[model samples]
Target: MSATQMDMLWMAYGKAGAVGSIRHEDDLFHVVMSDRREIGAYPTLEIAKGALISHLKPGTDRPEFRRV
Candidate 1:
């Protein structure tokens, strides 16, 4: 895969909360909330994206998924 593709994948995985450290094997990423809640496992990147999208400010740099 190209560098761009790899970056996209990493972005997807990261958005899914699958890029952080965790103890669970099934976890994609460890999400630590401001409430001190650590969500270890999540479903898919799309789901995570949906959950986070609304909370993101308008001018924030969002991750764009593209075909490489």
Candidate 2:
């Protein structure tokens, strides 16, 4: 990840409330839940966001990602 990407933070929110976060590190994007469970690392931000959204409970709305 580049310097700018490394400093960026993305918050994930779903119908249930705060779901997790996305951060760039070691050239990959990681999705970490509020409970501290790590989903996995992805090659790009879009993929990371998709993973986070997909991790939500069934019938939940897609997560809203906000940059922080």
Best by TM-score: 2
Clash number by candidate, in order: 3, 0
Give the residue spans of candidate 1 off by over 4 A: 1-9, 12-41, 59-62, 65-68
TM-score per model over all chains? 0.31, 0.85
lDDT of each prediction vs. the true structure?
0.38, 0.86
Off by over 4 Å in 2: none
Residue range with the least summed lDDT across 10 consecutive positions in model 1: 4-13
Tens digit of per-residue lDDT, candidate 2, span 7-66: 577998877778899988788888998899999999999999988878877888887899
lDDT leader: 2
Query: Residue 34 lDDT in model 1?
Result: 30
The TM-score that candidate 2 achieves is 0.85
Q: Candidate 2: deviation at residue 2, Å?
A: 4.1
Q: Which digits, one per residue and each the tens of the lDDT, describe model 1 over residues 1-68? A: 34432322223223443222222124342333333445444455555554444344476455443222
